[model samples]
Target: MAEPITLTAPNNTSYSQPTGLFINNEFVAAKSGETIETVNPFDESLIAKVAAAGSEDVDVAVAAARAAFKNPAWRGLSAADRGALLYKLSELCERDKHILATIDAWDNGKPYQVALDEDLAETAAVFKYYGGWADKIYGQIIETSDAKLAYTRHEPIAEQTPLSVLYLGTLIKEAGFPPGVVNIINGYGRTAGAALAEHLGVDKIAFTGSTTTGKAIMRAASVNLKNITLETGGKSPLIVFDDADLDQAVKWSYVGIMGGMGQVCTSTSRIYVQDTIYDKFLDRFKEYTVENTTSGSQFDEKTTHGPQISKTQQEKILGYVESAKSEGGRLLLGGKPGAEKGYFVEPTIFADTKNHMKAVREEIFGPFVVIQSFSSDEDAIEKANDTEYGLGAAVFSRDIVRAHKAAAAIEAGMVWVNSSQDSHFGIPFGGYKQSGIGRELGQYALSAYTQVKAVHAATCSGAHASPYRSGIISRNSSLDRGSILQAGDHVSPSKRPGAKA
Candidate 1:
């Protein structure tokens, strides 16, 4: 069994992090008894070790979920009651926001203040929004002929067996949810994630990760035809017109790519500026980026950027930078690794990048931005849409009509007007094409998490009358010999008339 490990943040706040899989509202060691070390990206120091779940752990978690779903304690709960529980969980998250933020900063290498103020706040708000929707998941009544009435119902899914996902399980238990209602197991994607994706008992899978892994999950889930919702990789573009506010465009472009060390899936990595103001925009953007962007420990209050999540990620970002330079991309500023110890990359920018450049085509998932100049609106749209990815995008223009028109034409899921990286809990978030499938956030997310079942009830006058009897009518008989018959009253079945069944 893996023992809880104590971690102390730069602020001297100490915590005993859980090192076990959370299942049936209890934290327990993985059946395999293996562990994976969790390290801090800022200093490359060991933070803690978490239990590494395997196929057996996934099975246990799925079985627990299946049993809980079958239990009336969970299945019999009213939608309002379930919603109350979610609300309670959101409240608990808000209460412990500071600790959560610290953990996120240590684990994910995002600025602590930003994690607290933005990411954690948004997470809580999302839960609260979904809570409000729990009781309002209504199904419509379909119009049909004969004495039949139909309606539908929605249901929940099973497990998420990742370290990040386990945090939700902890919150759910704190909110007083029933045992096994939500299970969390921690391990590598190849073992735990694949097992959960292929599990027959798991009715749905909501994944947010790389497109490569998302494809694997899709293939695995195809075996059971499990419902899948994927929010995958993005090589998004931020288009700035000649008439746009230069300062606003520069700031938003920075936020879109450099925010969270560019680990966001919807980061605007490719930037297109109008040729008329291209040079001016590039000079100002470089100045702003160099002057404002700071990289260091996430806990430092002055740090605007943090280290990459892992050594492997840092290497990947560096590789992309080298590839960009080799492919004729001019390095504008900061194209190398940061400090000696940690997994940090300097805020890198490449100019005069072509559409075919690796830095523009692939998802670096680091603080790297590629700038390209466009001659016209058509050129900008064509370049932006010239990727397999169709995730988030941005358009900046003073003309409202032109901006909206460009936004509509962009081949992406979400588009921001004169802004970037601004997301709301109420708005639907997802991507198009290879970026992802289905949607997350808003009421649309409920569709992915729940299934709809149609139910029909017969309302015939006679209790013992067969439901098929109404459809059977005499071929040669007429209700009124001299009267005209209604369209529905005519029978066309071979069993009743001179027609094929």
Candidate 2:
């Protein structure tokens, strides 16, 4: 049996005061003075009350952001200077990593060490990477005919564009955009989220969360045609080939699915194994889970998996397990929530799962896995790409050529070879199909946040009329040099050096 982890509100801690909405670098109360109580998902204990930003508070935040964007101090700063601020923020986050990690553990219900090490570290890296690119946003110059010059100017789209809502606040601290150039208002999606997305002033909206909500944001932004980027839900697949390193594949699967309580959007929820090694792989995978993972609190280093974000989530995962069994999916291991005070579920695995079952189709968003066997490579690709989501997928194989081929055929924005759940800062992360629009991360991320304009200069000394009595003739004649450059020295036969009349 796993033990319950408990947390109580500390009177002496800095967080004793309720955390309020962060707007314009200041925390303030909502207009209605409404608030929501954050409960520890583990013990259902009162953690802290967060201000629920109503329409009025959202208005204030947007207005403040607008002011900052227009202000000379922020708008006039060079991109290099802006990036430096992000670098500073990253340093500050590293200094207080321990404290922030604790907050995430207590509020988000993930392990303390992971929150500190992986989440916080990655958050800092994200900021640093973007910061480095701040000054590097560039455009291209194109050559034209007749001394004409043209170039494209890459510039910030507008003031206070809400590119995304970093629900994971740690990512926000890591994004390092200039204060006014990138504003984040912390509030529920129904209120603040909706306002930011639909606000006429906002140029674009980028969101990462459940698909159900992604549609809502799209609908709201549609009214204004506000540019949108969504990194939505995913039912990612992991294909284990017959020639794979079985031990590593099984171990990596365990880490990917069970590490974050299976809360990650790209977590490998669906595992497809070649028939030759199906039973063997299952044996090792189940053994690893039983020996390693345990349902428990977020603070314990001994526990590999913790409670879901809340009780509702716990019920949802349990429901899927039942649905899977009812639909003829064989439950290989755990299928029930642990008998404990917290919202914890066992590290469950199901075998012989059908393609159409809810567990296999929907994003379970909990610690659960469904397994099915594939007889051929084509079948494995078919099974993996069956989901509507094309967010991410993984393949394990010893042959490099086979791995690359499988990775290419997998219908996902990103694919992993012989590994799972590893993400880097410069690599772009987003999905194709229903996974969402626009990439986030690296220079691609910055591209989604900006727009482009072309600048052209036409130098001409007028007053000399065209000999053909047409000004457009000069435009065509001037193109000869450009055409020569573009198409090589292929002059007309009449103008050839030796054959010319």
Best by lDDT, which number? 1
RMSD of each: 5.1, 8.6
User: What lDDT does candidate 1 reach at residue 35?
Assistant: 79
| Candidate 1 off by > 4 Å | 1-3, 157-168, 462-501
Q: What would the TM-score be for candidate 1 when compared with the true structure? A: 0.91
Encode model 2's per-residue lDDT on 100-127: one tens digit a residue.
Answer: 6666776767887788889889887887
Q: Candidate 2, 388: how far from true, in Å? A: 0.7
Off by over 4 Å in 2: 1-18, 158-184, 460-501
Over the stretch 148-238, how does candidate 1's per-residue lDDT look in tens digits?
A: 6677877565111133455566678889899998877878898889898999988888898999999999999999899899989999999
* Model 2 residue pairs with clashes: 127-174, 163-206
Model 2 is weakest, by summed lDDT over 10 consecutive residues, at 158-167
Scored by Cα lDDT, where does model 2 land?
0.76
- CA shift of 50, model 1, Å: 0.5
lDDT of each: 0.85, 0.76
- The count of residue-pair clashes in candidate 1 stands at 0
- 399, model 1: CA deviation in Å? 0.4
